[model samples]
Target chain A: MIGAIATAIIQATLVSAVYALIAIGFTMIFGVAGVLNLAHGALLMAGAYVYGIVVMRNIVPSMTYHPAVGVIAGIVVVAILSLLLYELLVRWVEDNVVITFLSTVILAVASTEFLVWIFGGQNIRISLIEGQFALANARVAYYEAIGFAVSWIAIALLWFYVTQTDDGRSILATSMSERGAQLTGVNIRMVRAKTWIIAGALAGLGGMFLGFDSGLSPLMWLNPLAVAFIAVVVGGIGSIKGSVAGAYLIGFIEQITVELIGNGFRGMPTLILLVGFLLFMPQGLFGREFAHE
Target chain B: MPVLQLEDVDVSYGKTQALRNVSLEVEEGEIVGVIGPNGAGKTTMLDSIAGYKEYSGSITYDGTEVSETSSGKLVNDGLVYCTEDRDLFPYFTVHENLQMGAQFRSDDGAVQESFDFVYDLFPRLDERRDQEAQTMSGGEQQMLALGRALMSDPDVLMLDEPTLGLAPVIIDDISEALERLQDEGLTILLVEQNSTFALRHAERLYLLEQGSIELSGTADELRDDDYIRDAYVGVT
Candidate 1:
């Protein structure tokens, strides 16, 4: 029983790390742009496909397939795609939430279809790390360990960027009040575009990590997307810290439920928790009441 | 030559015209006041000048045509507008709020200079610099708003109702600060609903009514005008 509990705890931490990585980008896009980017899942799929083509194709040869290069390529491709998304689609329809939602939905569908066309309808795998270790009577894959470290590092870097950098402060200012930002001579368009790019890159890195750990399929993004959306909403619609905490909360709930009941009921706890939070404590943990502003 | 000029400007919001063929100028280092009743196109005129509203007219600032310039560009060009609402970043500390005013400026030395200038102008803000803006009183918020505008080191400062919702003592303090800023060679175009305050401070005043300039004169000239006295100055 102790071993089983330890295993559940380890699994929860690993899973929560990945969820946090996936949900941070979604929360940021919503917080800064005030647009629910439904295409976020699609962007993750695009990143996975990009990684698949770059590393899994064997075009670079197994001897020369550097994981760093693959990750950078994935991030760069997604960042460029996100910038294009903002300029071409989001910028025009940003003020109207419904239109933004519809446009991003279309983009998501288009992206998924594009990926299917390019990569075919088969699952692809890229092994990031080659070993596993035992800890407290539970086994942990090297890939999962690396993913957890990367997620925390990324979160730390993002927090520093947002709190310490001038451009990041400008983004916070714009999120607070567009008119106020304008009066201060902040180029709001540039801020918005940069925010989307950062979000896309983060999503891409997350996809790469997830694909390396569990393999990738065209439809893999959907579940993670749902998980991220629930995390964002449960944490608080626009709070980064809330999103992270919410991700861990969901992750632990899922792992504990799976350990106690079974895989069939794994999703039930998160669903219930989401509903409870939405109904009772809408602000989520660490979320401010004026987050919408 | 005037530092700013508005020639025959007209602004409309949908079908309702907010400003009609309004023309005005602000000479360098002068305090020009615009006073009018509510809905008299006073705020609309400032909005048009600040590029927040669309208008059909020529607006020239510092010899450049600024009718098409965005508000962000206008601020970088040294024209700053402090709106009546005091649209501050409420979550930020007073110091951070002031820092935002100079976000686009590259010269750290100049930015620091402006910060010192503002702190000197309103020492109360310096005292509460670490406090969040939303926690302050209405008068302090107004002071922070003014200090924030000054932090941009604007060559031409446009103020809209800086004394609104403040106590009479606070109003006097703000009026004295404006006088000091004007003395320091800042070109100011002030819009106020308080006709008495405007007449006492402005070198020249424009009386706007129903989207048109009904009267324009020196402060002494308009203060004694019987119609102006009865209509705006609250003297029966």
Candidate 2:
């Protein structure tokens, strides 16, 4: 029983790290650009597929193929795709939230379909680390442990960038008031583009971890997308710290449920928690009261 | 030649016209004031000049037509406008707000100099530089708004009602700051509902009424004019 509990705890920590990585991008996009980028999931899928191709197909034959290279390539490809998405779709329809939402959702579907065509809809797994370790009667995979460490490091780096960098502060200023930022000579378009790129890179990095842990399928994007969205909503729409907290909250709850009540009932508790938060505290735990349009 | 010139400018909000054929000029090293009652297109004029409002007119700054320029580019060219609403990033501390004002400038030395200049101008802001702008009183916020505008190192500073809700002492402080800024050769275009303050500070004044300039003269000339005294100066 103690071993089972320990395993559940380890699983919860690893899952939370992945969720936080995915959700942090979602929250930042919402906070800075005020758009719910449903295509975020598509970016993750793109990253996973890119990583899969790099590792499995050996895209660069002359160079030694490493898992780290796959991860980096995934991040770079996703970042570029994200910038393209912003320029082609998000920027044009930014003023209209409904249209932006619809366009991104459609894009998500199109990207997933494209992935299905390329990968033949099969679960493709790439083993970055080929071993597991035992701790307190609980076993943890080396890749899973590496993923958790990378997630925390990424989160810390992001936090430092946003809070300590001049460019990042300009983003925060733009988020608060577009006109105010413009008055300060900040180019809003450039800031938004950079934000999309950063968010995409993060989603891409998270995608590599997700792909390593559970393999990749065309439909794999939906699960992470749903969980990340839940994390963003529960933490508060615009708060980065809240996104991390919400990720852990949902992660632990899901793990505990799966351990105690069986895997079939794992999602039920999170759904209940989401509904309770929406009903009682729509602004979320860390979200400020946004101005009404 | 004027440092800034607006000729035959007409601005409209959908169907409602806010400024009709408004023409004005501010020469280099001059403090030009636009004084009028509420709803007389004072703010609209500033908006049009700042490129925030779409207007059909020729607004020339530094001898270049500026109707098509974006506000951010305009700021980079040293045309800064401080809106009436104070439009501050409320969550940012006073110092951060000032830093934001200089965000686009690549010259660190110049940015630091601008910070020192603003801090020297409004010592109160320096005292509470770490405090969030929203927590400050109305007067301090106004000071911050003005200081923030100055941080851009503007060649022409357009102020929209700088003393709208401040105490008398605070108003005097603002007036003194404007005088010092003018003395330092910062060309100003001030719009004010407070005619007395405008009349006292402006070297040249334009009396705006019903979206047009009714009278334009030096401050003393307007002060002594019978129509200006009765209508704007409250001297029956």
Give the top-scoring candidate (lDDT).
2
The TM-scores, chain A only, for the candidates as listed are 0.93, 0.95
* Model 1 lDDT, residue B121, Cα: 84
Residue-wise C-alpha lDDT for candidate 1, range A1-293, written one tens digit per residue? 99999999998999899889889889888887898999888887777767767776552344345677778888999989988989998989989999999999887877777767866667777777688999999999988998899889989998888776667788877877778888888997898898899889988988887787667777778878888989998888777888899899899999989988998998877888888878998777766554445
Worst 10 contiguous positions by lDDT, candidate 2 chain A: A56-65
Q: Candidate 2: interface RMSD in Å? A: 0.8
DockQ of each: 0.79, 0.81
Give the residue spans of candidate 1 off by over 4 A: A57-64, A289-293
Clashing pairs in 2: none
The C-alpha local distance difference test score for the whole of candidate 2 amounts to: 0.88
Task: List the RMSD of every prediction in angstroms.
Answer: 2.1, 2.2
Docking category of candidate 2:
high
Q: What residue pairs are clashing in model 1?
A: none
Q: Tens digits of per-residue lDDT for model 1 on B1-236?
A: 89899999999989999999899999999999999999999999888888778788788888777766678888999999999998898878899899888888889898899999888888899999899888999999999999989988899999999988899999988988998997899999999999998888899999999999999999999999999988888743
Error of 2 at A35 (Å): 1.1
